[model samples]
Structure formats: structure tokens, C-alpha cells
Target chain A: MALFSSLTPVFIAIICVLIGVILKKTNGEKEKRETKSKPLSRPWVDEDLKDGTDHHLEEEDVDEEWQGLDENVAHVPFFAERYSEGEMIKRSQMFYELLNKRRSVRFLSDEPVPREVIDNVIRTAGTSPSGAHTEPWTFVVVQDPYLKHKIREIVEEEEEINYKKRMGDRWVNDLKRLRTNWIKEYLDTAPYLILIFKQVYGWLPNGKKKTHYYNEISVSIACGILLAALQNAGLYTVTSTPLNCGPQLRVLLQRPANEKLLLLLPVGYPKKEATVPALTRKPLEDIMVVM
Target chain B: MALFSSLTPVFIAIICVLIGVILKKTNGEKEKRETKSKPLSRPWVDEDLKDGTDHHLEEEDVDEEWQGLDENVAHVPFFAERYSEGEMIKRSQMFYELLNKRRSVRFLSDEPVPREVIDNVIRTAGTSPSGAHTEPWTFVVVQDPYLKHKIREIVEEEEEINYKKRMGDRWVNDLKRLRTNWIKEYLDTAPYLILIFKQVYGWLPNGKKKTHYYNEISVSIACGILLAALQNAGLYTVTSTPLNCGPQLRVLLQRPANEKLLLLLPVGYPKKEATVPALTRKPLEDIMVVM
Candidate 1:
């Protein structure tokens, strides 16, 4: 009777955690659950992994299938039909409300945002699709005033050189309109800065193997999703690649050898009054050519 | 009067031809009038080719006052209100209508789509944002049965090795859920295969140089936009990057050295009967975080 009582408490605790986590993730799709027909025809569990009912792999790297086909033959492959060609798009209500309203702020309010916001935004970015599912990324949130200054100083040093020496007359001439400089004020002004990094191929978690595939696409997908999530959260962001601070900043941050910094985004509210360049977009007709 | 009439015909004919050529190059954003903030701000005009402007360079390379910024920098450093962040993020009627309905399709039909659709789609893809607006990309529409056969032959070769030999038990175990293999039938089954290439940089018409930034990011953004556009047009596509075909396909296509084949997407209709593996996305809590 005592053992049963103890077991009951543990099971209930696990259920509570699961519920909390589920609540955290569930969003616009809740209403569409019933409408979802299984989109695939292939068996969810491979014959090798199925142990009568459960679906996860029972063990790692157990490659028993020696199924081979002639490389030259263009055989018809299987495609499951859980999702139809026309109905896979799910416009998220939460994201739509948020991303549709997001504004890029050049001038920022110096007010510090709740740390919770920064952490959550980074967490959302971490869920992006990566090459070979490598999940090759790192997020460094800078809240320290001193570190912000240091980053700014290093970035400015490079910008000055670019403007003064490295950048050619043609390139500098093009940049003349927006009046951008190497000294990024947003780096210092915004309460938080999230630096995104893409890890090239790296060792597996077991530290025994190499992996391959397109990581750039995977990282960009994550970035796209991140942009949508941040906008939904009632914040402003600018995804800017800091060209000048590459080598120096990486050393300053002490990143791993395999990682390359992709973008340094400044996140916060716009200044009480801010102005963006009035840029025009190409017309839809110009972009779209329907047959 | 006769002299005037003769000049008018000649002038009008040249202007018409010029516009026809320009129109072909103008991706999507041509509908918006070029914002005329200043004559100096236009991207097309050669800044150095001054026609009695306030400052003409006599000693360009030696001039210390000239900011080290490249001459190209003057080409509208930022595309002014070309798009407001809000406008850029808003769901366009076409984009919304299409993106809201997008589904990834592994199923493909052998029925050939008209070359017109392929032409229009590739033209649209050209408008995608590129690194430094270099537009460093090439699309090889492969409908040639002979070449498609060659591509499938090579891709399967590596994939066969990956699935059976090189892939570890852990890697194999993780891949079981996706239910994919070295077997690729879509290459032949789809009516048209769109091969995307990333050109690192390009030469100007004058043989001067240009540089591209974040080429992969730029290319992927274009790909996302292209995918969204293609899906919106009621066409189906699946993005596949078979890096194994990088050398052979490039040689086959005669792409320049800098260009890398990144994605080989087969575009057409999903087969009446198609099957995909049973896969469920991670719950919202697992994928999204709230601050």
C-alpha cells in the first residue's frame, strides 16, 4: 500500500510537468486537430524498430536492411498522403497577429526589457530546421552594459577601416544613401542583443562521427521562424550581419572552432520617435508571373 | 518637318527596344516608381561618370577626403521605403493565399507542365533577394530525360552508401522516422526538375568586379520566396539538395566555377496516390517558447 502511494505521487508529478509543457507549446493548431487526416501512407514505425506497438528506435545504429537498387534506374518511389498538395499551409493566428504587425526599429529605447523576453526569443530560435538536423547554432544574449560597449568598440574599429581603407569607392558610394556606419549604435542602445551562429559540420553527440547536408537552408528556416515569433511577441528587431566584427568578436566571445557568427540582432522597443527610410517594394505583378 | 519625323521614329524604336530588354531583367519590384529622392541615389546610373556634377574625381585613388566606402555603396545604400518593415511582413493577398495553403509534397506526377509555367516560375525566382543584390544564382530547368537519368544515377550512388555503409547505427536509427532512402523516383517522375545554383559573385558588364555577402542566406531567402510563389500558383514542388551531383550536373549545365548546385526540386502535380511516412511535428510547447 505504501509503495503504491509513493508511485501515485511520482506519476502525478510527471503528468503535471507534461501538461505544463504541452500548454506552453499548443497554439493556433488546436482548432485544426480534428481536421488533420494522417498526411502520410508509410507506416510510422519501421519494421526493424517496431516491437509490437511502441515507435521509437529500440537501439542506435542497428542497420540490418541491405536493400539495394541499381543506381541508374529511375524507380517510382513511395509518397504518403497525410497532407495534400493544396492544404499543408497553416497560417498561425498567434504568429499572424504578431509578425504581421512587427516594425523594424532603427532608433531604439534604452529601457531594459524583462530578461524573460530575451531568453524566450532565443529559445524559439533554437527550434529551427538545421542541416542534417545538426541544430548548428548558438545564441549569445548580451545584457551587460560593459560587454555591449566592448562589442560596439570592436565593430566600430572595423567599420572605420572599411569606410576609410578596405571598402572601395564604388561600394562606399552605394552605402552613402542610408548613411550607415561601422559604429552600430543599436549594439549599445538595445537592452538585449542576440548573436546567432551556424555550426558547420561537427562531431556527433557521441563524438565519433561526421555529418553532412545543407545547414544554410535549415538555419535560415529557423531565422525566418524566429522573426515571426519575435514580431508576434510585440517586440522589434533588426537582423543585421556585422561584417567588421567577425574574427575579433568571435575571439572575444570564445565561440567553438566550428561555429560561424551569422547575425547580430538588436532587440527592443523603438525610440519614442523613430524614422525608417521610406523604401518602396517591387509590385506584386513585378514579382509574380502567373501562367 | 520631315527631319523631325525621321528622328522621332528612330528615337521611339530605340526606346521601345531598351524598355523591352529592361522589362525582362526587372524581377517583381518594377511597378513602384523609382523613388527619386535624388539623382545621386539611383542604383543604375554610374556615379563616377559625372556630367558636370558638383564634384568630379580627378584623383580618385589618391583622394584622402573620399571615405573608404566603396563606390558601389552610393547605389542607394538602402532601398528606401522600397518596403516598410510592416509592409514587408504583412501577408500579401497572393502570398497569404498561397502560403496559407502550402504543403510539402513528396508525391509527384509524370504529367508534363507547360514550359510557360516553368519559364514564369524561374523568372519569379530571379527576383529573390540576393547577397548585396548581386543576384548570384542560376536555374537549370531539366526536362531532358537523358540528364535527369544521369542525376538520379549519381544521387542514389552516394545515398546508397550513406544508408547502408557509412551511416552509423545512431544515424540510421534517427533516419528511420523520416522513411526516406537512396531511392529517388521524383527525379524522373516529375515533369520538370528545377536545378538551383548559387554563384558566389559576378562580373559587371564592364568587366569590373563585384562581391556577394551571405550568399547562402540570400539564396535560401530567394528559395523560400520562390517556393512560396510556386505553391501559390497551384503547382507542387519539393526542394532537394543532392550535393553529390554538384560536379557532374555543373559540368552538364556548363555553370561557371563559382556557381554551386544547391537544390534540385522536381515540380509538378502530386500523384493521385502517394504516400509519405507518418511523422508528427513536435508539439507547440516543444517548438515555441513564451517569455
Candidate 2:
């Protein structure tokens, strides 16, 4: 009789466990269906996953990607001198005025500029922020007359076709007021042409391809800074994007196939009689919206 | 006999002119054939098209594109106080040093920031250069908790799939050192989220679509400037790009189809116990090549 009583209790315990498992699985499936239907719900909250406390900071053994690279980092004490609000406003205004005075110049003088100036300007450009610090850019300084002559020839050939046939009527009409033609004398006359090439991918020492993220955006930021640097040095430049520059220039410059030409900037002094079309930028109010 | 002699001279002159025209046409055809074969040769040059002389500046009646727009331009007297070369160098160095100290912060505090500060920072971003001065960008500031919660949930949902399935092994391997996972609590915790939307095309008042040029590059430059402005104001922000953020965020923010989401920045003060991955930027020589 005692043995039978014990057997009965064991059977009841097994049934209770089975019932709990079935209930838990049914709840899980229901929650999944709800999540699929309404994605913007607070269904996926795990209190343990939150890094809200100071405990995460105490974990010094965390494996970060940089830790695997074993790259050396230099620490330097930084102390930025605080400026009065008035001084800050004054400096901001000054920078705005300086940038506003910048204009695209077509009439260039063949006056020679020091190589050191170009070097400094490029260094300033290098300071631009990039995605993941993958600075995928190379600035090639072309000053040789022969190379410039060759580039000009190719650019003009393409531009001639662009103006005559490739460009639609509306495009041509829009450019009429700018008075730009296929013949680019400035390309030949400028003292320097900074050819910015963007590296789409990189090769490791073992020949594995390294993918670059935001290469176009990163290079464009550098180009903007380059313009500012050149202007600050009392030099003028025009942002030229010659169609079909990638294939021809790559061959001429002996650059690898991985790099693509981004910008061709003809940099030099403006001719004494240099004139730009009387153009005005949209007012600040039109461009900016306050919400 | 005198009349016959005069007519004969006139006939001789006409014959000489015809022969000259024929010879010029033959030479032009030959040059075109040569250009087709050897495009690097300088086959195009028009002395009249060159703007080297100062005479073009004297013409006031030249029709400019802006002349047709009839937009009122405010001509503010701009007289930037010139700094000595030494002072200029000092200022540039200081600015560079300040920027170098900026690091991407992940842990954010929900400390309330003044609206005026955000306004100034956005104004600074508006000053960035754009393609043809089109200024094709819109910055939408979101401070509503409900909207942030929705964005966070969507981002985390996609990120979870990305970490588990969508992203390849190599990409996940790369992200390991960063110690990041699908959980992004900063989106909800940060006081303000600046959603930068890039205008792919604009709708005119009459509902006609206006094409934008270099829209991607222009918006990227503005984003860089925005980051700098935020840093300059002693605020912290992370350049967060939640994958598949376009369609969902567009619906949540009520943005138009023509505008695409470029960046989603979470801005606020860093948490007291915030810690970042120990990473180092590539040195100048690694990033820049002067040729």
C-alpha cells in the first residue's frame, strides 16, 4: 500500500512538469506573432543588456577591435584656452566672411607657387574627419607641362562632345550665362593641378582586399577643406570634374586600377583682369529652417 | 577692251578665293582624322576663347544666370580684419588641436540641452559649400520620446538580424573589437536626435521636380561641418548609421519620398562613466601621399 502511494505522487509530478512546458511554449509563439505584427513595440527589453550602470566601465578585459590590431596610441594632454562669447562670435563672423569671398575663377595666371605652400595646404586637407578613420584619398600634384598638356587635350575632347552633342538643350542653356566652353586654357596655364584620387579598396600585405566605407563622402569632405586651405593661402582654384577622366588619367599617371579620379583642381593665382559671372548665393533664411 | 580687262581681274580674284576655301576644308578634315587617332595631341585651341586679358571684366551687359532669378541679395559690408601670418598659423594650429581631441561617444546622458545652442550649431552647418550652391539638405530635430522609442525599436530589430544573419562573418568579425551588439539604448537615452535628410530632388511651387547635382557629396560635407559645430560647442554626438533606416524613419518622421535619410545623430553630454574603445588614428604619412 505504501509503495503504491509513492508511485502515484511521482506520476502527478511528471504531469505538472509537462503542463508547464506546454504553457511556456504557447506564450512564446504568441509573443513572436505580436512582435511580427507590431514591430515598434517595447517587447524586446532585457534589463541585463542595458549598459546604464558603471559596471560596464569596470570591465577592463573587454575585447575591442582596436585591441586586436595592437596599434600604438600616443596620449597628449589637451588644454583648449577658453574664449569669451564675444571673441567666439567675432571669430565665427570672420571665418564666414573669409569663406564668402571665395569664388570660382576661370582666368588663371601661370605664376609659380612654392611647393611648400602646396604641401601645407594638403596637410590641412588631411585633417578632415573620415569614416572609421579609413582615409582613402591620394592627392597627386601635377606640375609637369607635358602631363598638363595631355590632360587638357583629353578633357577638351570630351568637353567638346559634351557641349555639342551629349549635353541636352536645357543643360547647355543653363551654362550659357557662365560662358564656359570646351576649350580649357586654365588647365594648361595653372601652376599646379591637384588630382584627388579616391581608393575604393585597399590591399593588405597578404594581398587580401580591404573594403572602404563612405569613400565618396570622406573624399568630398577633404576636398572642401582643401579648397578652404588653398584660399587661405591666397591661391585660387576651380573644382573641375572632367568627364571620362578615370580611364585616361589612370593610364597617364600610372595609378592602379583600384583608384578613381574624384576631382581635378587647377590651382594658381587669378589673372589681374580675372572676372567671374556676377552670381549671388541664396540668402541664409532661404537655406536654413529653424524648428 | 577696257571693260573686258576689268571683268577678267574680278574673275581671277573669285577663283583664288574658291581654291583657298577648298584647301582649308581639306586641312580641317585631315586634323579631325588625326585627332581621332592621337587624342593626346593639342588639336583644339582658339585664341579668342582665352580669358587671359582683363578686357572681359569691362563688359557689364553680360547675361548671368542669377540675373533671371530676380532674387533680392543683401549686400552686407564685409571687412575681415587681417591677422598677421604668425597669428594665422597659431589660430589654425589651435583649431586643429581642438578637432583632434574629438572622439565618438556612445554612452550619452539625457541632460537637457538648450534649444538656442542647437540652433547655433545647425546655422554653422548651413555655411558648408554645396554643388552649384544648391544647398540640398534638411536637418530635422527630434526630441519627442515617443518618436525616439519607435526609431530605437526599428533600428534594434534590423541590427539584431544584421548581427545574427544579414552581415557576413567578415563584417561581424571586424565589429567584434568595437564590442557593439544589436542593442542601442543611446537612441532613446539621448536628449536630441538630429535626423539629417538629403534632398534627392526638389519639388517646385508648381509641383515640377528640380534635379539636384552631387547631392550625396554636398550632404556629406554638411554633415562633417555639423559634427565640427557640435564639437566646437562642447557637445558630444555619435555618427550613428542604423542599417535600413530610410523607409521606416521616413514614415515615422513624415518625410517626403524625394528626401532620403543620410545620417541619424544622437547628441547630448557623455555619461559620467562612459568608456570607448581604445582606437588610434593613422598618422599623416599613412593617410596622405604627396606626389
Candidate that would win on TM-score: 2
Please write out the lDDT profile of model 2 over residues B124-149, one tens digit for every residue: 66766664455778887888898889
lDDT of 2 by residue, A177-264 (tens): 5566788998899989888877765554554555444566677777876776665566777776665556688678877765777778
User: Retained native contacts per candidate, as fractions?
Assistant: 0.04, 0.09
Candidate 1 chain B has its poorest 10 consecutive residues by lDDT at B49-58
**lDDT against the true structure, each candidate:** 0.52, 0.62
Model 2 stretches with alpha carbons more than 4 Å out: A1-98, A111-117, A228-235, A269-271, A283-291, B1-94, B112-117, B189-191
DockQ of each: 0.03, 0.04
Chain B TM-score against the true chain B, candidate 1: 0.64
